[model samples]
Target: MVNVEVIATEELGDRSYLAHDGSVAVAVDPQRDIDRVEALLSALGLTLELVVETHIHNDYVTGGRQLATRTGARYVVNAEDPVAFDRVPVRAGDEIAVGAMTVRVVATPGHTFTHLSYVISDGDPAAAPAVFTGGSLLYGSVGRTDLVDPARTDELTRAQYHSVRHLAESLPGETAVYPTHGFGSFCSAAPTTGGPSGTIADERARNDAVLEPDEDAFVARLVAGLTAYPAYYAHMAPVNLRGPAPVDLSPLPVLDPAELAARIDAGEWVVDLRDRTAYAAQHLTGSVGIGLGPQFATWLGWVIPWDTPLTLIGESAEQVADAQRQLVRIGIDRPRGRATGTIDALADGRPTRSYPTATFDELRTARGEDPVIVDVRRDDEYAVAHIRGALHIPLPELADRLHELPDRRLWVHCQSAYRASIGASLLDRAGFDVVLVADEFPHAQELGLTD
Candidate 1:
């Protein structure tokens, strides 16, 4: 029997796997991590035959075209959309054969008009099937309807409900179901906190949206709970559709401190992905800071321009490589070069300083001091209300308007500590003394800020 090995994308936390039958392999929803996929393919010694994109993903730039180009594999997508790749346009009822395995495409378009789920079956008619449901069907929820035309929210909602029903009724009860996304992803409302793969029967029992028969009600519930899409999504969709120019990662001329300063003064952000303390002491002028911490990949993706070329300032060569890998995970492709002799390069010139941050209690104590409290959470979270006198900057917009912040003590907070930490760190690196509020506010009343 052929074996399928699923690999989660580094940044997406979504499932992208390789299905192989000894001699040939097919990749599903490949992320931008080409090296990792290549390594896996090399280890398996199987020729890559096909790349199947389940839908047009908006969250991160896809690597399907890149993978197909490198491996000479056919790129497959739903026949409805003219996806830019070596073409194998699959439609509902079409079956693609890879060696001894057969993949049947099922049009499942609630997530987007072109979403397709593939059912993989062994060539033997008696063998059961496994479905790669992409974003169309998830463990406990359906893909959000607002991703497409806002006016057709209802129609898309109906489509999703029927899609779930169709999968449930048509696929055998024992068919394995694997989804592309999981919890902590923006794609679905109720994401599975478990692994990348599950079964149709398990999802049918546990997934609330999948179990619901009333299409309109399901749509209403899903739409009501959607978090705001990241600003990157707006740019990534069209870029992916049209295909971006090949990224050039060749080393650029190493800039001296003066040249780096001039670039920073010209409004180019120098992101130092070293440790917080190193960034705190010395960095290029106007460089917003993020470290190679746990949330490094996420904050980098959130704050930096996807198209912008990054001049990485790392403490060591290893850190620079780590930073590069992190950036690539989220599809940030234009890495200009790493600053060698990082400390020595800045020793002859003035090093930029970082900002200071305050704690929740410090915010409370200094409430009367009139410090500007910037809540970096999204507007929807702020609509539920925020600390009194807190300005809503949203982490994604913080880099653009750092000058708007008054030259006073700045305090920042988000739902949990994650975003606030990132914002505070950036502000700190950009020369603002900011404090992160570590307390979790269960209700609006807990926030002691004034209106």
Candidate 2:
């Protein structure tokens, strides 16, 4: 039996895959931090035979080229892609033999012009096959079509409908479906509905592409539902097309408390890599708290000025290192410096900043004061339901549009407080008196706080 292992990057809502027959292996859509894949292969005692990319990813940087270079493996890319680096170009109808298995390349466009999916099978014709659907056929929905270009969105959406249908029709019922995106990634047209693994038969019965006999309706809903993705996405395709350089995971220089404060004073980004709750309690006045987690890089990249010098303030050296790994996936190679230890120690004599944490029930009581209530969730989320008089500022656009918010005590919130914490930090750094709403938005509905 062919063994398949999934490496999930839950922060990015994507997955990289490794499959082997207990001896040799092939990787699909490896992230920029090749160390993880390298470590996995080493532990398994498997020889790296091929590193393949279904398409140029618009989320994290691809490690296929770099991994192949390091492993003496052939890097496989779509034949039609206008990529700069040399590789074994593949096209539809091509099949590659790897030991006792066969990998068939199938053209599955719509996520991008030249996207492909790999169908891997053992020699037995009756055995079920495994297909790696990069961004084409997701678990329940399809990959969002608007990421390429606005003008091509309609064209691509139509192609996506056909591509998904094509896959369902061509593949057998029990073929295991391994998609690279749609776990929670914004690349999905809508939130996907499935656990870790699924099959083609599962999709055929429930997938919108196959269920909706009319293509136009699927395209309409998909186009209308496209929300804002991370700003860093604008840079990913260009960098991937040119072949991204191998990541620099070197440790950053340790900064003294004085230099950490100085960097904040110089208008540089001083980010606190502590948990949102702790950072909100007491943090260095100017440092923005984006808790180190799955969502760290996505929010930091969205709100911060690109290429700005950044200094990290963490509770320990390990927290800074964790942030480093998340940032490099989106191409923020190295931070300018780092400061570790207690927030007070790092602050030294500088005044600290703080904000109150509240729930929807508390917000209702505080509403009598007429404080500005800010909703930082996406537009679709706000459109569906929100506080009656809350100001709408999607988190991604909050940094650029702060002037639009009135100078008042602001109660910031999102679907969950995860984004509210980031919004609260940004508002706090801009010298606004902000309150972090540390409650799930659904509670607002329960409390009749939503419109």
Which of the numbered candidates is closest to the native, going by highest TM-score? Answer: 2
Q: In model 1, what is the error at residue 44, expressed in angstroms?
A: 1.8
TM-score of each: 0.88, 0.97
Query: Where is the poorest 10-residue window by lDDT in model 1?
Result: 244-253
Clashing pairs in 2: none
Off by more than 4 A, model 1:
193-196, 244-253, 293-298, 305-309, 329-331, 340-347, 368-370, 383-385, 399-407, 425-433, 436-451
lDDT of 2 by residue, 81-164 (tens): 899999999999999988777889999999998999999988788889899999999998899888888799999999999999
Clashing pairs in 1: 355-428, 355-432, 356-433, 356-434, 357-434, 357-435, 358-435, 388-449, 388-450
Instruction: Per model, state how many residue pairs clash.
Output: 9, 0
Q: Best candidate, lDDT-wise?
A: 2
Query: How much does candidate 2 score in TM-score?
Result: 0.97
